[model samples]
Target: MSTEPIDGAALLDEVEAFHRRFNVFPTEAAYVAVTLWDAHAHLLDCFDSTPRLAFLSPEPGSGKTRALEIVEILVPQPMMAVNASAAALFRAASGAEGRPTILFDEIDTVFGPKAGDNEELRGFLNAGHRRSGVTYRCVGDGATQNVVAFPSYCAVAMGGLGHLPDTILTRSVIIRMRRRARNEKVEPFRARVHEKQGHALRDRLARWTEAARPLVDGVFPEMPEGVTDRPADVWEPLIAVADAAGGAWPARARAACLELVNASKTDDKGSIGIRLLTDLRDHVLNGIDRLPTVAILERLHSLDEAPWADMGGKPLDARGLSKLLRQYVTADNEPVAARNIKTGGGVLKGYYAADLSDAWARYCPPPPESPLLPLPPLPASSQP
Candidate 1:
């Protein structure tokens, strides 16, 4: 190792390079965010909150575990919490030795179908985001039992098979991992050989963070436009670290923040009601004014990638769809309801386009631009 002091920007560059050597992230933004996260773990005391770094994928062999393993070596007091009980996690994080940087692999098993209720564990993950966050627990037995508060503030990174609970998801920097293509290649990580190199980088990060503490503590870095609310909280520390690092990092960090934040909005797998409204706007409505109940159900069920075909273990019928949309209102403040429409043979119950306009605008993004929209007719003055 060099005897000289560490350069923050150059050290971050080295950390990014180290990750690239062993892991293939889905986007350039993903790599940038991960790099900043690794650096921020060393200086958790300087910030008010620590965003959980989540690596999630739909299928197996997408490198979720490898990402956590790589992070395990680079953080302070790394603790792997797979299958750990809630009480165990609380004790480990609140220990006097130091708050462990919790690395949770196979996290899906904690929240999956087979797993029993894990409300306490979930609460721990949620509350730990803020510096003052804590969990209240009753300890002792009989007359001695008393409630106590345990500090839940700690840096956590998780790798899981599917989505996290909404409470945890809002506080996380979500990386949607994908399987590598045939053309993409990465170095095989061998803990025995590569861990030493990772540790060296980790030590350098520690030194840099020590030097940066005075500059970053209580400093709120300027956020990119449109990044507000929970997202602003989640990205604040990472952006502050980037700003302190100087060089091209401040700009790069802001860009990464914008890209990843916007991507999360578009990629959110929202509630079923919201999904139904979105699907109707994008797939069923088109340019037509109204769709009969039967016709609407047909289009929704035919979608191969949608859950309408098997929602609640059966196809979503008109009654269910009506119940879902009943909560939403029209422009006139009337609950969205099915009205009768006259057809060639008889009057049929269906939804009108005007009634759904408000819900579509409020609950979903504007429909994608379609090429099939007809062009305006030639103006009268210009007509030949």
Candidate 2:
């Protein structure tokens, strides 16, 4: 860990070296995942966004917690905690100058089913993916009690067994950890020895990031061919880091971005938003000029064994339906806002079929091709 002038590739290499000391990241994607997190941790101020590093494992002894402990030492201004409440995390992130890197270990204990719903924390994590995130909280007492907005932008690294809420996962760069095979071995992480290395590496990374700012600050580095939307957002910083590195790192970074981002997509379950869009296209949008919001809700609720039938123990309503589908189309207003449409019904409002078509084309899967039927009996009498 030298303070002398260093290139981005060398600095990233050092980070990877430090990570490998305590953990055996099962795949190249896994190794790149941690390296990018360490790189992003140091350059948080330079980028508009950063993705949370979610280290999840199927069970304990998967090196998930061990990885977090190591990460706790590498990031700049890390707020490392074995057990921190949502309030503590919010305050820690909001009150910090550069917004601390949150290294939360055993996260499932605080976020799992037994821990009950933590929508606020979930929302907080989700919001932080963008630089514009803010969380409002009521503070003080009596007349002093007024809601204040807190800056929610911060880099988070979390480790746990099993999956987090889908909302949190969507904004994260996930590293699925696993137990090391008998043949694979790593130096046991001793706090005394490892912490010093971690600190030195952090210092080196900090110095390099300061020097490399010009190459990356506010620059939109080119993305891989298929990377777009949220996946593109998640990888922007890493790709920038790779470009700044100026070597084979750029190619490696894109490969890892494509491999891991594609791997994160769930095969068994379809995306909820896409599924909703398909349902609307098939059953609701029938070239009508407009449909009352009430009619849409009724149709959605009529579907058997669907979440809309009894969403949250209450039938899905217009407002709820709007919220789910809102991300696809324009807001209540806008030309492509890119999908807002007319709504009306005396005191109630409706939606235009034209507005929904754009969302259908973008979000819905293609309908299956109709099978051709054999021509009817070839006019049997004519053949005779």
Best by lDDT: 1
Each candidate's lDDT (Cα)?
0.91, 0.78
lDDT for 196 (candidate 1): 98
lDDT of 2 by residue, 178-255 (tens): 899998888988899879988988887778788888988998889889788888888999888888887778888989
- In model 1, the Cα lDDT at residue 258 comes to 95
RMSD of 2: 7.9
List residue ranges in candidate 2 displaced over 4 A: 1-3, 96-98, 266-361, 364-384
* Tens-digit per-residue lDDT, 1-384, candidate 1: 566767899999999999999899999999999999999999999999999999999999999889999999888889987888778888877889889999998888998756855898999999999999998988899999999999999999999988888788889999999999999999999999999999999998988898889989999999999899899999999999999898889999999999999888888846778889998888888678998999999999998789899975899999998999999999999999999989998999999889999999987866777778798999999999
Which residue pairs collide, candidate 1? Answer: none
Q: For residue 117, give model 2's deviation from the true position in Å.
A: 2.1
| Per-residue error (Å), model 2, residue 324 | 9.9
Global CA lDDT of candidate 1, please? 0.91
Count of backbone collisions in candidate 1: 0
TM-score of each: 0.85, 0.73
Candidate 1 to truth, TM: 0.85
User: What's model 1's lDDT at 324?
Assistant: 93
